[model samples]
Target: MQKILLLSVSAGAGHVRAAEAIRAYANIGDAHLEVLHLDVMQYVTAGFRKIYTDFYIKLVNKAPALWGYLYNSSNDAQADSSIEKLRQKLERMNARALLKEITAFKPDAIICTHFLPAEILSRQLKKEVLNCPVWVQVTDFDLHRMWVHEGMAGYFAANDEVAFRMQAQGIAAEKISVTGIPIMPSFTAVASREQCAAEFGLDGKRTTILLMGGGAGLGSLDAIAARLLAMEGDFQLIAMAGKNEAALAALQALSLRYPGRVLPQGFTDKVERLMACVDLVVTKPGGLTTSECLAMGLPMIVNAPIPGQEERNADFLLEQGVALKAFDAVTLEYRIRYLLDNPSKLAEMSIKARALGRPAAGQQVLDTVLSQHP
Candidate 1:
C-alpha cells in the first residue's frame, strides 16, 4: 500500500471543501491513503489566526479597492522578494511542524489544495530536506504568481487560459495540466429537478432561485432576499444560510411572513440537490461554489465577490458567458428580474454552463498525482 497526504487551510471554506472533494475521489482503500486536512492557522497562535482572519474580513468588507490593489501587485515580478520573505516567516513556524509530520508519514507524494502548504513543501524539496513529488491543485481560475513555485511536480489548473498563464511564468507547459477545479462528486450527479423540488416541498412550475453565502453566510443576503420577494413575479426563493445561526433564524422568521414562497435552510449537506432544482444561483463567487454551480449547469448571478481571487473568479465566469454580475442588492434585483423575464437567454447561458462543466475534475487530478508517483 502507498501513502498520500492532502493538505488545506481554513481561511475560507472553499479550500477545505476542495480538499474533501479530492479525498472523496481518491478513495484508494488498499493504498493506505491518509488525508491530513489542516488549517495552517491552527499550528500558529490564536492571535495569529485572529489577526489574519480579521484582516481578510476587513479587506473584503471595507477596503476592497486596496485589496484589489494588493492582489494586482502580487502579480508584479518585483514583489517576489518581499512575498518570498513573508512566505519564509510563515514557513519557519508551521512549515517546520508540517515537514516533521510529512517525514513521519513518508508519503509517496504530497498534494496541496492551498498555496501555503504547497509553498512550504516546495521549499522543503528545494533545500533537499524532502524528496517526494509535490502536486498543487489551484482552486481558482486565475493563476496568481504566489501559486507558482519551483520544485512542484505539476499544477492542476481550472482552464486552458490559466495553464497558458502558468506556462508564460516559466512553468513548463507539460507541468501545467488543465483539469477544472475539483468539486464534490455529488455536484456531477444528475438529480431530477422535479424530484428535488418535490422533496423540498417547492413548487415545480415556478422558477427557483438559490441564495447562498458560501459556508460562513456573509453577504447582502437579507437585502437581496427582500427585493426578490418584492418583485411581482412567479418565482420561489430558497436561501441557504450556512452555519450562520443568526442569519438562519432571521431568514426563518422572514419566511413565516411569506408563507410557502420562501424557504430558509441552515447549514445543509444537500446543496447539490437544491442547486439541481434551481433555475439560477445568486451568491458570492468563491471558487468551490462557482465550480459546483458550473457542474450543475446552473447559471449564476454573482452578487459581491471579495476583492482578490474571487474577483478573478467572477471575471472568468463572465468571460465564459455562464454568469452575470451585480455589485449591490438593487443591481442584483434588476439582474434577477431580467434573467427571469427572458427564458430563452437563460436557457442559452445554461447550455454554455453545461458545456464548460468538468464534472470529473477530482478524478483527473487524482490520476495526475498518481502518474507523478508512478
Candidate 2:
C-alpha cells in the first residue's frame, strides 16, 4: 500500500473540505492507496490553532477591512512586515511536532490544502529534512503569495487564471495543473428535481431557489431572505443557514409566516440533494461552495463575497458566465426574479457552469501527485 498524507488547516472549512474531497476520491478510486487526512492545526499549540482557525472567522465577520488589508499585504513579497516575520517564526516553532509525525508516517507524497502547512513543508523539503514529493493545492480561485513556496513538486489550481498567477509568481508553468477546486464525490451524483422535491417535501412544480452563505453563514442572509419573501413569484425557497442558529430560526419562522414557501435547513450533509431541486442558488463565492454548485450544474447569484479572495472568486464566476453578482439585497432580489423568469438565461448559465466544472478534479490531482513521486 502507498502512504499519502493530506495536510489541511481549519482556518476555514474550505481547506479541510478540499482535503477531504481528495481523500475520499483516493479511498474509492484507488483501493491500494493508504490516505490520512490531518488537520495541520492539531499539531500546533491550542492557542495558535484557535487563533488561526476560529479567530479568523471573527476577523472576517467583524473587521473585514483589516482582514482585507492583511490579505493584500501578504501578497507583497517586498513588504516583509514584523507581523509576518513573527507569524512565520511561530508557524515554524509549532511545526516541530508536525515534522516528527511526518517522519514517522514515512509518506510517499504529501499534499497540502492550506498555505501554512505548505510553507512549512516547502522549507523542510528545501533543507532535505523530508524527501517525499510535496504538492500544494490552491483551494481558492485566487492565488495568495503565501501559497507560493520555494520547494514544491507540483501545484494544483482551481482554474487557469490561478495557474497563471502562480506562474507569474515564479513557479514554473509546467509545475501547475488547473484541476478545478476538488469537490466531494457526492456532488457528482445526479438527482432529479422531482426526486429531491418529493424527498424534501417541496412543491415539484414550483421553481426552487437555494439561499446559502457557505458553512459559517456569514452573509446578510436574513436581509436577503426578507427581500426574497416580499417578491411575488411561483417559487419555493430552501434556506441553508449553515451553523447559524439565529439565521436558521429566522428562516424557520418564515414557514409560519409564508406557509410552504420556505424550508429551513441547518448545516446539512444533504446539500447536494437540496441543490438538485433548486433552479438557482444565492450564495457567497466560497471556493468550495461555488465548486460544489458548479459540479451540480447549478447557476449562482453571488450576493456578498467578502472583500479579498471571495471577491476574486466571484469575479471569476461572473467572467465565466456561470454566475451573476449582486452588490446588495435589492439587486439580489432583482437578479433572482429576472433569472427565474427567464429560463433561457438560467439554462445558459447552467451550461457554462457545467463546462467549467471538473467533477473528477480530486482524482485527477491525486493521479498527478502520485505520478510525480520518486
Candidate 3:
C-alpha cells in the first residue's frame, strides 16, 4: 500500500479541517491506501505552536486592520521583513521532530493543507533528502507568496481565479489543478427540506434561513440575527453559533423572544443536515464553509469577510453568482428580504452554486497525486 501523509498546521480550524476532509475521502474511497493525518503544530515547540495559532486568532479578531495590513503587504517576493525571517527560523528549529516523523513514515505522497510544512519539505526536496512528492492544497480562494515554494510537486487550487493568480506569480499552469476546496463527504450527500424538517421544525409556509460564523462566532452573527428577526417576513432562522457559548445562549434567548421564528444550535456535527433544511445561508466566506454550502447546492448571503482570504473567497462566490456580499446588517436584511420575495432568484443561485461545486474534489486530488507520483 502506498503511504499518504496528510499534514496541516492549526493556525485556524480551516487548514486542519481541509486535511481531515481529504483524509476522510482517502479512507472511504480507497481501502488500499494507508493514510496518516498529523498536525505539524504538535511537533513544534509549545511556545511556537501557541503563537502560530493564538496570534492568528487574536490578530484577526482584535486588530483586524493590522492583520489586513500584514496580509496585503506580505504577499510578494520583495516584502521579506524581519518578522518573516524570524518566523522561518523558529519553524526550522522547532519542527525538527516533524521532519523526523515525515522521514520515518516514508510516505509515497505527502499532502499539506497548510503551507508551513510544505515550505519545510520544499527545502528537503530541493536538497534531494526527501524523495517523495509534496503537494500543497490552497485552502482559500486567494494565493499568498508563502504557499509558493520551490520543489512542490503541484498545487490544488480552490478555483480558476486562484489558479490564474498562481500562474501570474510564475507558478507553471501544468503544476496547478483547480480542484475546489475539499469538504467532508457528508456535505456532498443528497438531502432535502423534507429530510431535515423533523429536526429543525421546518414548514412549507415559512422560508428557512441558516446563519453561521465559521465555528467560532467570529462574524457579527448576533447583530445580523437581531436585524433579521426584527424584520417582518414569513421566514425562520436557524442560528448556528458554533463553539460560542455566549452566542448560543443569546440565540437561544432570542428563540424564546421570537417563539417559532428562531432555532439556535451550538457546536454540532450536523451542519450539513442544517444546510439541507434551509433556503439560504448567511455566513462568512471561509473556504471550507463556503465549499460545504456549494456542495450542498445552497445559496449564500456572505457578510463581513475579513480583508484578506475571506474577502477573496467572497469575491469568487459573488463573481460566480452563487452568493451576495453584505457590508452591514441593514444591507444584509435587505438582501434576505429580497431573496425571500423572489423564489426564482434563489433557485437560480442554487443552480449556479451546484454548477461551480466540485463535490468529489478530494478524490480527484488523491488520484492525481498518487498517479503522478515520481
Cα lDDT for residue 99, candidate 3: 89
Question: Given candidate 1, what's the lDDT at residue 139?
Answer: 93
The 10 consecutive residues of candidate 1 with the worst lDDT sum are 214-223
Which 10 consecutive residues of model 3 have the lowest summed lDDT? Answer: 214-223
Q: Which candidate tops TM-score?
A: 2
lDDT of 1 by residue, 106-165 (tens): 888877888878887777888898898889889998888878889999999999998999
Candidate 1: clashing pairs of residues = none
Ranking under lDDT, best-scoring first?
2, 3, 1
Q: Against the true structure, what is each candidate's TM-score?
A: 0.94, 0.94, 0.93
Name the Cα RMSD for model 2: 2.2
Q: Give per-residue CA lDDT, model 3, range 176-285, as digits (tens).
A: 99888888888777577686777667663468899986322324566667778888877888888888898888888777888888888988888888888878998888
Q: Give candidate 1's error at residue 13 in angstroms.
A: 1.0
Q: How far is candidate 1 from the true structure (C-alpha RMSD, Å)?
A: 2.4
User: What are the root-mean-square deviations of the candidates from the true structure over C-alphas?
Assistant: 2.4, 2.2, 2.3
Over 1-374, each residue of candidate 2 has an lDDT whose tens digit, in order, gives 89999999988799999999999998887677899989988899988988898889898877777888878877874536787788889988899999999988999999999998999988798889888888999999999888988889899999888989998999999999989988888887767878988999998888888988632332356656767878888788898888989988877777788888889899988888898888899887999999989988889998667778988899999999999988766677778888978999999999999888888889889989878773
Off by over 4 Å in 2: 79-82, 214-223
